[model samples]
Target: MTNDLLGRHRAVLPDWLALYYEEPLELTHGEGRHVWDAQGNRYLDFFGGILTTMTAHALPEVTKAVSEQAGRIIHSSTLYLNRPMVELAERIAQLSGIPDARVFFTTSGTEANDTALLLATAYRRSNTILAMRNSYHGRSFSAVGITGNSGWSPTSLSPLQTLYVHGGVRTRGPFASLSDEAYIAACVEDLRDLLGHTRAPAALIAEPVQGVGGFTAPPDGLYAAFREVLHERGILWIADEVQTGWGRTGEHFWGWQAHGRNGPPDIMTFAKGIGNGMSIGGVVARSEIMNCLDSNSISTFGGTQITMAAGLANLNYLLEHDLQGNARRVGGLLIERLRAVAAQVPAVREVRGRGLMIGIEITKPGTDEADPRTAAAVLEAAREGGLLIGKGGGHNTSSLRVAPPLSLNVAEAEEGAAILENALRSVR
Candidate 1:
């Protein structure tokens, strides 16, 4: 049955939409941290649908909200006032650190980022953008242009002239050998040099932690340093928090807070998890930047009533349950356990990330070269052991990504860690 469905999926879907494992399982239902396949096999879900299920699978609160809202209305275009949309927007605006903030919703992170690009270019009157070296933004033309990862980006032709910047990844680059402070200095100097040779850029967009780049991140204050330089030159700082927002990082509610000594970013784009599986994406910026567009704009399905209902319920549950605190405590133990396991496995090149977002970089034994083959083996092994995980990296796709729901408990973390350890061992 799974094979038949896979055949149909491949026949109609874009070839670029990749699936995991040698044979993919058809997940039919989920509860808490566990999901059941069509064939009756159960597995612990660690990647949380690419980290979109922020709270839990089949969360009662979100489920109830969706059902209740659907009974009333699924959508009532932007032409009419939407109570749920306004309420969700208000909640997000208050939560967002940007002052005098305004919110505009989209259907996906890609659209959220695309909206951000429109605002930045209009506000700053420049088409040049600074993006991180190993970052993945979205699949849209503008987002793809700013995306520096070769694996995800397909075309060189773009609407915007993007300038790739350094400092997103702390390892595997010319400045990898430098100390934390020195690395920041070197990256900032590089940015300054790049600025001198280019047209005035509208903004520098970056992920607090490079999600598709193996969850890699630079020193805590690196962005603060970059903010200083960009602020002096009037270049806006845009934080792509699609994967790093809403306290997923444990220590910080927003990933940018780690380097927020200067203050919040000028604009922020978010999706994937805010609605807890519902299609909800948005951009938050100070009124000046958000309102820069001269013509009126609206997303036909951006802030639909049903999705807003889901977003409100999910956000409330996440905060009321203090999932961020849970993420810190449990994710701490999980990382330590994986680090211990990785120490015994030579193919495990490095273990990195914070909170529930972690990455295990696989490499050839006795060398620093990326080993995507070993990574694929570990992924398959983990699935065989009844655990669902994810894989990502730069062009090589050689890192194991582990981003479970923020509500994940200690027992689940330990169980997933054990399965992952055995998987890594099997591959080794």
Candidate 2:
């Protein structure tokens, strides 16, 4: 049975397709923030499955919800609404503060972004969207195009302007300590200049806080300027909060909230943390904007009964514990400790981000920017040291994105920090 399972896909999964697995572990089961491989080795999961497992791995409430929902109905087309779907959508709407919202659910963040892109297009009836460069939306065609990162997709396939990037490069001041006003001014100017083009834009897409282009939390004032400008030009502002939502960004339930009311977006996309690994993504839009969608068509399994049940359980967990507050507290401790770790190792360029979604920027010996090799090495060393982490930060260099569960404690963060520090020191 094991041989058969391994052989089934060997024909297509070639050695070159081993990017994510350059140092892969055969992790079998996970509980809370810890995972164990088939070999019985334990590792602290600092990456939290790329920020998806919000509550923790196989959390009791979430598992119970899935178990019960599975015994019941798992699929019901959107042609007819189910209780779970209705309740889950309502709960997210209320939590998100986007009332009168008509939810469209998908199975992944990419799909959600695809839906949001289509939604923006339908509402504005325009052919172009202004995308920030070095931004990452998703892996699907449309999502990839709007991702804002060069080399990730064909330049031609990209939205109207990939060159519209601003504040993407860490124009630094640790996001927590930065002057929010100054950061916003700089980003807003670049956005205005981008929109100054003769071509009309249907929408302007952004990550309230970028996840893939390193975990960057730009100034708070950016979104409002973009929103106001986009609205004045009759363009929608799409907030891709897949990584920042679900209490990962501290007191703010979503990245938009991190920006405050001043930067509230018109439409927001969420997925990673919503279902806690249930593979569900959602879109929330103002009722007026949704009016333009000819969305009578159905998705056979989008927000299925089981998916919604799981979503509700995740929602309950978030509210019951106020995980957002926990993220802020734990994230602060992580930043402080991580900075100290960097201070000990000169190769660490900087520590960036807010909440649990953070990154450690590394530099080569005497060279600036992160070192992709060092990044990969540190990732391997960390894993070897019993921790799980991820790498991104599109420069020639590499940075580790540390997105632990909101439920993570100061002690766990300290342990993860120790592992990371050891990993950084290992390169020598």
Candidate 3:
């Protein structure tokens, strides 16, 4: 049955739409942090559908909201005043920390980032964009242009001229060995030099944690340092919070807060987790930036009633349950366990990240060279051990990604860690 479905999927879906594992398991249903495959096998879900199933699978509030809203009306184009949409927008606006914030909804993070680019370029009257090295924004044309990861970026032709910057990854770079303050200074100096060589950029777009880039991040306060430079140059800061928003990092509600010494970003984009699997994305910016366009613009299908309802319910549940606190507590234990186990595994190069967004980088036993084959083997082993995790990195996708729902508990964290430890050892 799985083979037949695989054949059908390949025949219909794009070739680039990759699947996990050599024998892709068909996940039919899920509840909380666990999912059941078509074969009735239950696995502890750590990846959370690339960190999209934020709160949990089959969360009651989100499920009920989606069901109730669907019965009333699934979609009412942005033409009319959507109560759910308006309410959700108000909540997000207040949460965003951007003064006089206005929200515009899109169906995915790609669209949200695209909308942000449009606003920034129009407002600054510049087509140049500054993006971090090893960053992955989205798959759309504009988002692709700003994406600095070669594996994810398929084309170079773009409407906006993008200049890749440094300091996103902290472990493997020219400044990797420097102290945190020194690294920040070096990157800032590099940015100042880069700015001298290029046209004034409209914005510097970045992910607080590089999701597809193996969950890599620079020292805290790195972006704040960059923000000072960009601000002086009149370049806007756009924080891509698709994966890092809503306290997934455990430390802050938004990723940018890790670098918020200067303040919040000029424009902030978000999507995954807000709707707990429902399609919902949005951008928040100051009124001056959001309302810069002279002509009209509207997302015909954005902010649909049902998606907004789901988002509101999900957000409420996340807040009321204090999932951020849960992530911090559970994630701390998980990472510590993984690190202890990794110390005994030669193939495990590093274990890094905050909150629920953890990554284990696989590499050769005695060198810095990435061993993607070992990473893949560990991933396959984890699945065999009844655990579902994800993999990503700049060096041929060699890092194991473990981002469970924000509501992950200490018991589940320990369970997942044990399985992952065995998987890592098996690969070595």
Model 1 lDDT tens row, 201-228: 9999999999988999999999999999
The lDDT per prediction is 0.94, 0.78, 0.94
| lDDT over C-alpha atoms for residue 277 of model 2 | 82
lDDT of 2: 0.78
Lowest-lDDT window of 10 residues in candidate 3? Answer: 295-304
Off by over 4 Å in 1: none
Separately for all candidates shown, the number of backbone clashes (residues 3 or more apart, or on different chains) is 0, 1, 0
Compared with the true structure, model 3 gives a TM-score of: 0.99
- Please, what is the TM-score per model? 0.99, 0.92, 0.99
> What's model 3's overall lDDT?
0.94
For model 3, the stretches where C-alpha displacement exceeds 4 angstroms are none
lDDT of 3 by residue, 1-428 (tens): 99999999999999999899899989999999999999999999998888899999999888888989889998879888899999999999999999999999999999999999999999999999999999999999999989988999899889999998989999888999999999999999999999999999999999999999999999999999999999899999999999999999999999999999999999999999998888899999999999999997667789999999999999999999999999899999999999999999999999999999999999999899989999999999999999999999999999999999998888899999999989988877
